[model samples]
Target: MNIQKMKELIDKLSQASRAYYDEDKPIMSDKQYDALYDELAALENSTGIIMAGSPTQKVQGSVSEAFEKVRHSEPMLSAQKTKDVNEVVSFAGGREVNVSWKLDGLTLVLIYDGGTLQKALTRGNGEFGEDVTANARMISNIPLTIPYKERVELRGECLISWKAFDEVNTDGEYSAARNLAAGSIRQLDPMVTKSRKLSFIPFKLISPARTTKSEDLKWLASLGFDVVENINAASNLKEVIKQFAPEKYDYPVDGVIIEYNDNQYARSLGTTGHHPNSIIALKWADETYETQLTGIELNPTRTGMVSLKAVFKGVDAGGAILTKATLHNVDYMKNLQLGVGDTITVYRANMVIPAIDDNLTRSDTYELPKTCPCCGEPLEIRLAETAHFLWCTNKECPAKQVRKFSYFVSRPAMNILGLSDKILEKFLSLGLIKDFSDIYELSMHKDQIVSLDGFGEKSYLKLIDAIEKSKDVEFSHFITSMAIPNVGTSSAKTIAAHFSTYEDFRNAAVNDDFDFTELTDFGGTVADNIYNWFADKKNVEEFDKVKSHVNIIYPEKKQTNANFEGKTVVVTGKLVNFTRDGITKELENMGAKVSGSVSKKTSFLIVGADAGSKLKKAEELGIPVISEEAFKNMI
Candidate 1:
């Protein structure tokens, strides 16, 4: 082995590892990194010369200047992960083990003393971590006080749910749930952590050890900790794999964890520098289905970015027929050498999202589009930090306005029922609607609308009624419906909560009297977006027109009720006495925040018949549950 080549590999791998584990960006694919790591390990073994900086020889830690560093009492080791089920089965040796989701988020260690939470630390390397106690305290699922009086410690994952992730990720700045969760947790302001709605699910009890893993999890739940859901006891790895379905989970999960039930026996098995021998992670095999790429479709987004979608022959993947997958950006397409008529292998990432795994036939013959498909204007390639994307150069592109209008009437926004994107496209083509205000005036074209292919007398009447009903909208909904750049439902809610009324907010924005940057999680970018949107004459005119036809109801001042004060409640399934919105509003009026998922902070989970994962999670977390009748009686 050449020493110089070995040294170069070490440096390259180290840099990539740091980028992946620390910065939440992978410079190379997992397969590429693993192959290079294997080569480096083999060279070291053959030459009997291990370089000091070799990734195999030591553990690397990330550095963040914002937080104070603290040493961990026990090392937090990574699990040995494998894509092969055979290896997992061989390691298990037919022993009964607990199978649970390997949550794709930041690892956190919590310490409790005298029945009160003491500290929370990130899993920085293994020996030390940055102190994140303040941010941890803001996590909805972290318990400030536990029932156990003795000093105890726990380890878990801090994660964001897909719903909350989507609500705040309007700008598409973060790519994955794990990346968003990591970034949210590392914020200098704890208010950012609170707004992100982070949750902690304990997987391990570090201190006051129990005999079995099941017992430990139960104990953790008893102490008011949200525990990871235990699927079932599996005697073999095959059973574990069969039971591991990531789609059913509310939170994002990268893989499944199979750990020995006997805690003492597993601990005795000992550790490596990187991972312990007791547990192994079973990652989803990249089972790729080959399909021929038919073509690529570029769709203009509300932000003027033309998103590329690959049209491919239909293939079954993860129980779904996938005909199209997002190409992500120009760089991704170029790297894959993707082209029309190429044989591409497609798979479902995490058994949910369809993705292109590889292009077997690197047919680089496909030409990139030089003009915007919608506007007939020349396209511009814009460079982001590490990627390049095609953007529509036309500022007044009709496709952009259509996308924005679609988003404005989306469920999270104004929620104009019975108006589908296809219908909107038709209306746009007919010049019946151009802006959001045109939606209210849609009744004027009722005769024309009813004459359309899908629209009839009944459907047109229903749409008109929905439009009328939507005029009495909440302040947050109105704000979200404006389609301000980078401003989504969550940020709109924050703004509504601060200003209380639409008039107050508008006055402050128009006069430039208030600094939006002072709001929690509202940085300079968000402030600029809000200011610029309000400053635009066209936007102001459109907003004024919409406001004239709508009644923006400000949120009521919450009443301090002993039953629900300062409580976080989650409602699941169908309600009998109250509609979903009604019950949520009632809870909010009583000084409770309604959350979608169950956690330790969830004071009550109102479950109904046909309840789903939230009920199961509430039970696992040992949260108090109530029926609709019981909830009504309490109120």
Candidate 2:
């Protein structure tokens, strides 16, 4: 290995990582990329000049600015992907090519150094990633400590279950499961992340080495971790795709991965600018069908928007399987020439979301609905920037109320126990809950609640107790329960902390004298929303009713300028002294601002065990890095 060549390769790889991470486009294939990375790693190991933030020692960087930076014991590299089967066959030569599902979820790298869960990270730019150890701990399937207890780092996708997705989408407007899973993992509240029921399926071993992919799955399974064990070894590319077709699986997988089973052979093959030359992914070929629409169904959603669902006869295009299609909005309908009795071609667009590919046949007699199906109210076609939808006239629709109420009592808000959609629906049907405020008056329906199906004497009492206990919620929780647009629980907490009480917030919003600019991160949009929410008399009346029944609690204001008052602290990694959340709360209470990452302005980096990259960065920049225990002592 030439030292000069290694330096050149490292510099090129760094440039490539920057291009991919910052630009969202790859400069080279995964195999070519991984080969260069391996070359650099081997060179560095032989001649010890590994950079502090080199790709050879850290996980890849992610896109979002929300998460904390974590240093990986072993850096995550991009996987090789290939659409052609000939490529897979070529890689295998005469040997068998293994086919498996390619999950489209956030890639999580979990490192267990010294028999404890050390760090968790997202693949950002194939060099540095966002630290998400706290969020990973909340995911049940990710083991806190593996049984082997040996130093090891594993890679997997953090995903939300389909059942949980439907449950969370009671309001019928949550984004795709992958989006929600990614969003939930980065949430500030551990409780909020926990309620998401995220699961991890360890797919690859990052460290402690590996020989075969089967052996890697076995190793993960030994630790009681779920591993995707769907492997089909085939002699050729056609056989690989046929065996691992999308139709064969119950769940969704983007493509099939084919990698060399032998670790030595894989290492010999090596990496490129963005992928491994040794591994190849066979993306499934999408099938399309041409069919005629029988009728259009106007489904009224919880938000009072009437969706245009096309009921079409089965159509087949190539090998793609799609029966029902989404019109999305009235604009999509008009653009696609979709109406009752119109002939259309359907295909799995990008082999994912089912879409109307084209209109093959047109019918002049097709008609559009003028009124909503549910309430028989006149529907209004409203346009935002890009699209238009039919909105129902009735504002107090039952579906809307139920959706709003469910969100109000969600884990982010009051977190009342035993409050589900079924129970809420039953209560609503009985004219018990008309708004979110109606939930506070449920004590009056004790006898009626106990009599409902699935509710017995013991259960009913517990539910009432849960509601009663929620009355003493902090001002932040109280604000979240209102379900104001764009104001999530974390934002509500930031606002509540600045205001100190609900009255202060109300006065600021209603009186218009308070300067919202004083609050850090508070923008005009948020302030306008606060003002608008209080401006509505109905909202005020509802809030008053809720306030009357539930006693909102406030924490004692912290004494200003305590120890570490003037000093800026950047908290990183898993804290042994306190939960990362606990330490953050204490630090904020003591008048210190807890920042997400390090800067030249950062006074100190309060680090915990397994305090990866940020600690290294702090050291390189000459910033003081202290342990959690030491931080407690200082306080």
Q: Give TM per candidate.
A: 0.82, 0.50
Candidate 2 C-alpha error for residue 527, in Å: 24
CA lDDT scores, all candidates in order: 0.81, 0.69
Instruction: Write the residue-wise lDDT of candidate 2 on 162-198 in tens digits.
Output: 6667666556543355656766776665545665667
Q: Which ten residues in a row have the lowest lDDT in candidate 2?
A: 22-31
- TM-score of structure candidate 1: 0.82
Compose the digit string of candidate 1's lDDT tens values, residues 1-635: 36887998898788667766676644444545665787888898889998886787566656576788888897777777778888988888877787888998899999999989899999887788899998898786688898778999889999988887887654354556777898778877675677677889999888898998989998887776768987546565586578667887789887899899899899899988878889998888767799999999888776788877789999977569999976656766776788899999888877776778778999888888899887799998987544577898898887776777777888878989878767777888789998889899988897898899977999999999999999999999999888776576678888988896777888888788899989866766678778888898888888889999999888878776788988989999988889998998899889888986665667999988799878887887778999999998888
